[model samples]
Target chain A: MKILVPVRRVPNPDIKVRLKSDGSGVDTEGVNFLVNPFDEYAIEEAVQIVEKGGGEVVLVSIGTADCEETLRAGLALGALRGWLVETDEVLDSAAIADVLAAVFKEESPDLVITGKQSVDTDNNQAAQMLAAKLDLPQACFAFKVELGDGKATVEREIDGGLDVKEISLPAIITADLRLNQPRYAALPQIMKAKRKEVKKVSLGDLGVEAKSATKILGLAQPPARAAGQIVGSVEELVDKLVNDAKVL
Target chain B: MSTLVIAESRQGDLRAATYNTIAAAKAKGGDFDILLLGSGSAAGADSLKEFGAGTVYYSEADAVAEYTAESYAKTAAALVGEKGYTAVMMGATTTGKDMIPRLGGLLGAGMVSDVIGFDGANYLRPMFAGNAIATIEVNTPVAVMTVRETAFDAAAPSGGASAVAEAAAVGDDRAKFIEYRLTESSRPDLGAASIIVSAGRGVKDAEGVKQVEALADLLGAAVGASRAVVDEGLLPNDLQVGQTGKIVAPDLYIACGISGAIQHVAGMKDSKVIVAINKDEEAPIFEVADYGLVADFAKAVPEFMEKVKALK
Candidate 1:
């Protein structure tokens, strides 16, 4: 069995992202980029599954050469090897899915694991799109996943609570935030990962349509909230809520 | 062009998300059709007529009773694709987040998730956890979207009844639903509650969560928690209110010991009136709070509870 985990390089979640002056895109000038926080969880889960059972974890990402660093980070974390699907064009969730679907056909991995969504675009779409494109069953928002008997049992967090689902192998699974805490790359492992070269694959070679259908019209800051006034005491706060706001 | 809105219900009762998505459809300024899937779906369809749905497409099948992502996504995609609807919309709930993209991919359509505003052509959605907004445009034949319910006013439940028709059935059993375990609570749902009392990391322990719950019960409000507290295992994940959690916009939101991270604010910033109670006066939560009280919440929350009790 082989596990294929897709990773993405996104702006650091803790940093505030600024929009370009002309409103075309986000400003990455002074921002630091790293493996999308959620994808780290995916990588962690992939490694755990392969370590418990007998399999190899293959990491794949779609981006430019800049993504090799992210792949190496996964390598340090325990992925057997990596494939960087290098493409300079801005691909939407749909286009990215096409590229991954092509890779899925070539690799024929037993499972495809990826983050629920990229914190950057906040578009929780890619994994679902890949599932659709490849005609595979998808278990999303997975908090707990178990692999055995040629099937995967996933506990997914839904609207009200959790639901347990059983999907056969050759499935796509999206990792939720609570899945697992990613471990830090140890110093020796980081040194070893530097020597592990990632294979670079061109987007054009896959022959998948790599253009995004969506367009960004503009970007703006949401309306600023009105500045609040400090109340003298809890009594004043309750009074304000009862008399002024009438919320009580 | 006509629009289609997917109606989601749990255990035969329509959830608030159904109404919110209908409201989003109404924002597009035209008559729209609503699609309801599952057993006893007609009742859900009947309830949705008032939400400006001129027609309801009721889809029922045994497999639709238990929601498998594949089945729901395929059903919706097939319906929207067959109808060639110009716009397909739904609430940005967990189910919507899971299903919308599959529909978009099947139709080769561009999708905007967690949409806050839709002005016919352009969509306004939050980026960087609500620090900035991105207005996007989709040029595909059909536009698929999931609206952030909190960003739009919920559609009214009273209006002229719409016609209901049985829609075509489409699904596959690639996955099986073993069971669902829901957190049973008598209190109002956090997403639709008019008032919310939310606790954060500063609350410290499960006992702290109880104190906040006591305050919430007094006001007939829903209990909410910041992602930090939920992640810390002091509260359940469903109560979490943040970027990755449930987005809510209640009339009054009282933050108890919550230091406002942008992710936390993104979930509740649309609240009509926000009250922040924290010992740290410099917390970013104060910037958005309509009323700020700088005090240790241990002292302040009890004071609030006592005052409301005395007033009652």
Candidate 2:
């Protein structure tokens, strides 16, 4: 069995990002980047499944040369190899799904794991779209997964509760939070990853049509809530909640 | 081209999302027919009709008794394929979030998720975890979209009658639902709660969590927690309110000892009235809070409870 994991590089979640004045996109200059936090869980889950089931884990990231660092991070975390689909052009979820679907056809992995959504775009579409494009079953928001006998049982976290689902091999599964805590790649592992060669897969080679179905017309900062005055005492706060706010 | 809005229900109760998605469809500037796909009773369709959708199409089968992205998407995609609906809308709730993308993919349609508003053909949604908003335009002949319930008002449920039509059954055998475990809580559901009292890392132990819950019970508010607290094992994951967790816009949101991160704020910032109580006066949460109190939650939470009880 072979597992394919897709990782994305996104701005550090802690830092407050600002939109460019021209509204083309977020200002990425002088900003730190890291593998999307959720994607780290995907990488970790893929590594664990391989470690238990006796197969290899492959990491794929679709972006420019900057994404090589993210793929290396996945390799350090225990993936056997990396595929960097180098594309300087920005790809929407649909286009990204097309690229992954093509990879799915080429690699024919038994399973594909991905983060439920990216912190940057928060679209949460790629995994399901890929499943549909590949004509496979999917389980998103997977909190727990057990693989056996060519079948995978997934416990998914939904809005109200949990849904336990069972799907056959050659399926797509998206990881949610609480799936597992990603391990820190030790210094020795980092050195090994540095020496490992990352194969580049280009959009032209995949023959994936990458036209975006949607266009981002503009970007702006969300309206900020004005911080009100600090209350001197608890009574003062309660008075405002009851009278001015009328929420109590 | 006619639009179709999908209706959702849980445990036979019409979900607030059904009405909220109706509002989103109305915001797109036209009336729409609605479809309820499940074993849910006719009351679900009748309730949706009150939201102003005049035509209700439905399909039911034992195979789709439980919601699965595969089955629901198949049923909805079939309807869209047969009717050639111009747009299909649903709320970006957990079910819709998982199902809409699959439906869009099957139809090869352009999709916008978690949309807050619509300007003609453009859709407004958050980016970078709510730090910024982006307006997107879809060019596909058929557009599939999900609405951010917090950004739209719930449509009134008293409009008029709707004609009911039974649609063909859709089927899929790709996956099986084994079981479901619903969170049992006496408090109101977080998404529909009028008031929410959320705790953070500062509330150290299980006892501290109890204090937050007690206050919530007294005020008839739902209990919520920051991701930090939930990750620390101080509360259950269901209680988490953040970007990865539940997004709530209650009338009153009280943050107890929560040092606000952007992720946490993204879930509750749209709250009508925010009150932050933290010992750290400079906690970023105060930046979005309507009222701030710098004090230890152990001392502040109990004292605030007393003040509220006195008001009663």
On lDDT, the candidate that comes out on top is: 2
Q: What CAPRI-style quality would you assign to candidate 2?
A: high
TM-score for predicted model 1 compared with the true structure: 0.97
lDDT of 2 by residue, A1-248 (tens): 79999999998988988889998898888899999999889989999888887898888999989999998988899988888999998888888999998887888899999999998898999899889888789999998999978889999988777889998888999999889999999999988998777889899999987777888988988887776879989999999999999999
**Per-residue alpha-carbon lDDT of model 1 for A83-195, expressed as tens digits?**
89998888888889889988888889999999988888889998988888888899999989988788999999887778899998899999987899899999999999888
RMSD of each: 1.5, 1.2
Displacement of residue A154 (Cα, Å) in model 1 is: 0.9
Number of clashing residue pairs, candidate 2: 0
Candidate 2 structure quality by residue, lDDT tens digits, B49-87: 666675898766776777788888988888888878889
lDDT of each: 0.87, 0.88
Question: Which residue pairs in model 2 clash with each other?
Answer: none
Lowest lDDT sum, 10 consecutive residues, model 2 chain A, at A220-229
Which sections of candidate 2 miss by over 4 Å? none
